[model samples]
Target: MSTFSLDTATVLAAGDASEHRVLIISLFVAFVLATLGITIWAGRQTKDATDFYAGGRSFTGFQNGLAISGDYMSAASFLGIAGAIALFGYDGFLYSIGFLVAWLIALLLVAEPLRNSGRFTMGDVLAFRMRQRPVRTAAGVSTIVVSIFYLLAQMAGAGALVALLLGISSEAGKIAIVILVGIVMILYVAIGGMKGTTWVQMIKAVLLIAGTLLITALVMFKFNWNISSLLGAAAENSGKGAAFLEPGLKYGVDSMTKIDFISLGLALVLGTAGLPHILIRFYTVPTARVARKSVNWAIGIIGGFYLMTIALGFGAAALLKQETIIESNAAGNTAAPLLAQEIGGGAGSAGGAILLAIISAVAFATILAVVAGLTLASSSSFAHDLYVNVIRKGNASEKEEVRAARWSTVGIGGAAIFLGVFARDLNVAFLVALAFAVAASANLPTILYSLFWKRFTTQGALWSIYGGLASSVLLVLFSPVVSGAPSAMFPGVDFQWFPLSNPGLISIPLGFLLGWVGTLVSKEQPNIDKYAELEVRSLTGTHAH
Candidate 1:
């Protein structure tokens, strides 16, 4: 560890009256009550498994669009990206661009077909044209893995936010947040189902965008619209400076680090279109056309949010100063909140405090909304893909399936909470990238090939899912993330076998290649003519549903 003599004790000593504590607690309580109220309301009208899982398939395009944005822009986008920009300069903005560009993939390739064919989960699409057991089993496993990683990221972000806002230990804050999230999400999904989750997402998205834009405008006002000057000043003050702007050599390490950064970027961009939690949201819309339109709206909203993050990051770099930030041990992650206080005025300054409060509240809400969505996705996979299809022999009633789904939601939420509490300090951005990589590696190939490739066989889907998942997980285990190989968790390990921080560069292609090769080797072919016709109709909104 590089030693810096910034006294964290002194920084923590400079305390303000805990006036914000009450406000924060009140906000949390309000969110819980509101979510519960919505669940109760949705319960009275719940008609069947479809209503519980897909909001009765009556959501308008715009409403679904906002919900999609809400689901996509989790704590990772709002807090993680903003912090990354504040700390890393232009490199952070590059991440924003990568995230935004993924929507183009969603719009052009995944959205319409996905919405048209699937019912509750991606398995619906994959199994629509193939054997149910193999496809459902593969998709369910992928969904669980991806959801766990994504949940860990959100939980980590929530822990950091809670610690910063409430003046508590990160460990304690992490536990509190995990428990809070688990309870709220379980209730939301178990009671309100999809409708409750959609409304919650919509409300949280509005608050998040408004909060980010408001903070961004204030920061710009502080600089008087001098964008060039702001960049210059931030570059000069930033510890990394020009290196940060250009993404030089990954901390003067080596060519391997550079490759790792590039691989990570690719994973993030490609992974968004394939994430089960995100892909399932597309199916909630009424039509493929609606799905297409929603993508456009989500793109615009998300793009705007990311643009504001660039300002927030630059504002933190220029105004917060590295010495002060480091002294607090806040590093890149704390930049946004610290900058907010500075620009808004001071710790107790009304404008700054209020803005900080809103941002914190939204961050909390963002985690809740996302975990709710994730739990629902995982639960549906268990109920629709696994339970009803396999154990129940596809003979279960809709009510029975819905009940199983509710119970599954509780089980998944509990597991995530347990993991989040244990793995509290893992980097949120890193976990998110891993989640994306796994999804792209394990899930995307099967879905895409089964839909578009004529030679896709059930054996191929099974081989691809297992092979891709194994490759990604194994590569990640050996990656710098776990072993401190290339980048030592501590200074003396020096055991890196591969240079890239992320495994997607290799794992994604390995997945696709394995699937194709498996198809060639398998003699059996799927009779998917009718399935393909249905998919085309779904994509074109000619389905008679």
Candidate 2:
């Protein structure tokens, strides 16, 4: 490691707090007002369950693609990954690749079949050939758990991010920010429904992509249009020197760390296709062809954005010192903003204030778009899979189901806000990792088998969902995140027994294994006729549902 004086790092000076606050608040108000207006328009048009849950199947391929980008690129991607790259160098770039590559799974396997079969939620597809109640119940549980876990991280990050951006020192202010986000997200789903949510996501995607492009272009200009020089300077300023440009700094070359890296890779690559929020995006389009086209469009946009992140991350490392970034926020969550302030003009300049405000407001919009998607997925699963089909014996009217979904949105949103206040100290990336592990473990295998397998039984589907969900949760509870040493979440308690923080390596295989074993041991005969019908429909997009 290179010996560099931490105290010598240049600190970006702060401008007038009142000015920054005014700019940020004004931009945020404009975004919220626009989305709320869309919600009102969508609400007036939403007359039944189909419109509320799937935007009346009206979104085009390009429109759904923008919405997908908005829902997928969360604050974690904008802030957390950029910060990691600033602090850890090459390892952070790996995250971008993992996130982008996962679209292949979505495109090649899940998207077409899912759109061809599922109507409202993921359970609709999984339970198509299997016994409805038990399978739907299992899928519903997994959907809720994954969505809530993911939502908690976004909500907590919102609170912390707003507090940092606005210079709000009080804990109460942070809680207020969390509640505000939760309430707005709830309204987006409960009132505007999926049409409103899709429009918000599309608008947010445009703003986010534009903001990232502007920042990246400025960073490139600062380097005088030389990549080699930029990398060299980033190495020199990183204090770790050349090692910062290589791997093994963030995740070392040890055996367990290697396994941890693989586990994380599995979750990231396989998990995107399994996410209920993303899966629901396909239902917004009217045709399987449109759904496939949406994924293709999403791949182009998402891939390009990740490339920009690579630039932004290295830009922060080269232009700003490590110590300065840590001092702003230990987790480096504020690195992107600090970079925005620097490249626009040194801090306190008019250019700096304006650029910082634009990026901050975009980040706030990112959180809202993602949380709304998750809330819709979770509440729709509860209302459609459990309440209407399971409890009411599929006798409930469309209006009743829509009413149940609205109430479920409020309940889930409230729970997320409550949990977020207490979990404000948790790492955003770590929470995201747990959500991914559960999605990959519990949902991916079932979806794949349901779509392709001829002998997949109801028992197998239920076993896979419950087993994968259980293994992921149990392993996380015993992993380093819960307890290990002073830096762990439960520092006072040392109950960590698992070697790795992520459980995808073990849980994913176990999930597939249980599904296989459950199929082999089942006495119930496979319904060949149903399988034939599902296969024909899934392949040809005819008579779906």
lDDT by residue for model 1 (296-388), tens:
889999889888887888888888777776555443545666776778777878766665666668778887888778888888899999999
Question: Which candidate's TM-score is highest?
Answer: 2
TM-score, model 2 to reference: 0.95
Q: TM-score for every candidate vs. truth? A: 0.91, 0.95
The local lDDT score (0 to 100) that residue 354 gets in candidate 2 is 92
List, residue by residue over 123-231, the lDDT tens digit for candidate 2.
9998888899999999999999999988888787677666756677687887897888889989999998999999999998999999999999999888898888888
